[model samples]
Target chain A: MEESKQEIRLPRLGEPAPDFEAPTTHGTIRLDDYKGSWLVLFSHPADFTPVCTTEFMAFAEIYEELQKRGVELLGISVDSITSHIAWVRNVEEKAGVKIPFPIIADLNKEVAGRFGMVHPGQSKTETVRCVFVIDPNQIVRAMIYYPLTTGRNMAEVLRLIDALQTIDQHGVATPANWKPGDMVIVPPPNTQEMAKERLKQRYECVDWYFCKKKL
Target chain B: MGCISPDGTPTESGKKMLLALQKGLRSPQDIAKETGLPLFRVRSGLRDIAVAGLAEQKDDSYELSPKGTELVASLL
Candidate 1:
């Protein structure tokens, strides 16, 4: 008998995001279409569930703010386009929050399979909450996952974007709980010569290996 | 069909998308509908044209930039 199992390919940071063409609430979309913008490709278990609903509202609330930061949001689930549309309309009618982003309706699970959104250990039928932060060049910058029972925190998502953009803009790493205006961690020197010279610079330093600087 | 080349030249579909925008089509869906192109093609074309400095994004819509308008006029 032939083997029945297939290996799941999860996305990794610094790798190109898996390209996909799928039907969305806005219309048919492809990963290539977002070539010039940062994308937050997030997946929910379903459309009408309580936790997903709340997450949708929160995503809606940050839609404009994300746009201002040159980020676009694309949601996904295994639900049909009909279900996605109806749920969006319902959210607008009852929750009064307009979902401004496009949502991919992965009825065939093609996208979920590519991104490994469905964890068989958790549930076979539904996808877990997953987020892939893709940069403008279509590289997967970060990935976050949550169980079915939990909703995502929008602030953390925003902060992650800020951190990545800051790293790209200023060539520095962000510390834990790092927000904008906080001192950024400088890269440690590889050479002893540079290490000695690094201490002479006007940056906050605990040691040669650890230094923080203001951009 | 592909929309734009890596060097920023507009392919056939990209040109059609730009013409659609010149005819007052703004959103990607609208451009796709008007040009009879796939939504993905329209969107990818829009991004490519924007990168080539031929288009500008305004909120949820896109429009031909001054450079884009000049290019279209020269093509005509």
Candidate 2:
């Protein structure tokens, strides 16, 4: 029974993210170095790809906003440092956006393998689109995996960080398709009487079955 | 070899990719016959973990990614 448990487990989510040391074009970075901050650990399929170029540029365009939220961005790929350097430079030159953060050269794919970024049948050596949001403690707060055929939603990523922060501050969950400034979902009452009272309480509801309380 | 231990062994770089060749297994019967997984659990775990990108379709069959294979192999 114990032997069966030796299998590879999912990355611990909503907990501290795993730490690693990897060489980049500038230098090596240990994942733990960014404590007390949020990390957007995202991956792309490969260097010199068109869709990935647009995504990176979009991230670069919003770099300051993410930084203002006390979050750091860590991009990774199986490409070598030289390839990463060339790709970033190529994107900067062609797209006119300076990629401001460090990109991990996961040539050995240690980080990718750990994170389940490499979907072999999809593209063996290439990473599919995956974004992991990790809080200061390193626990992954959110994970979004996209197929090799699709690009990720950048706006949603930022919005999620905002939503997560809002929830942490107010102890309320966001409603479906929630955006900033939208009403939050209040927790239900602890007792049956309270639950009955809650149904009577004035809140937005298609019915009590799908009710939402604003904080 | 494509056969991995229950330890989530990393594929030895050039190991035969048995999974990459699988097409959609369609049902628990196929998954059970092909993967040796229990019919009931394979169907449900497929639905549950599919949201997390576990089982994926290739042409018409089901296969596991290196990472997903590592994940399930470990669960064994």
Which regions of candidate 2 are displaced past 4 Å? Answer: A1-9, A197-211, B1-76
Candidate 2 lDDT, tens digit per residue, A22-95? 76543455676556578899999988988888888988887888877878888999999889999999987887
Cα error, candidate 2, residue A119 (Å):
0.9
Q: Chain A structural similarity (TM-score) per candidate? A: 0.97, 0.88
Q: Estimate the TM-score of every prediction.
A: 0.77, 0.67
How far is each candidate from the true structure, as Cα RMSD in Å?
8.9, 19.2
**Top candidate when judged by lDDT against the true structure:** 1
> Chain A TM-score of model 2 versus the true structure?
0.88
- Shift of residue B42 alpha carbon in model 1, Å: 4.9
- DockQ, all candidates in order: 0.15, 0.01
Off by over 4 Å in 1: A1-6, B1-76
Candidate 1 chain A weakest ten by summed lDDT: A3-12
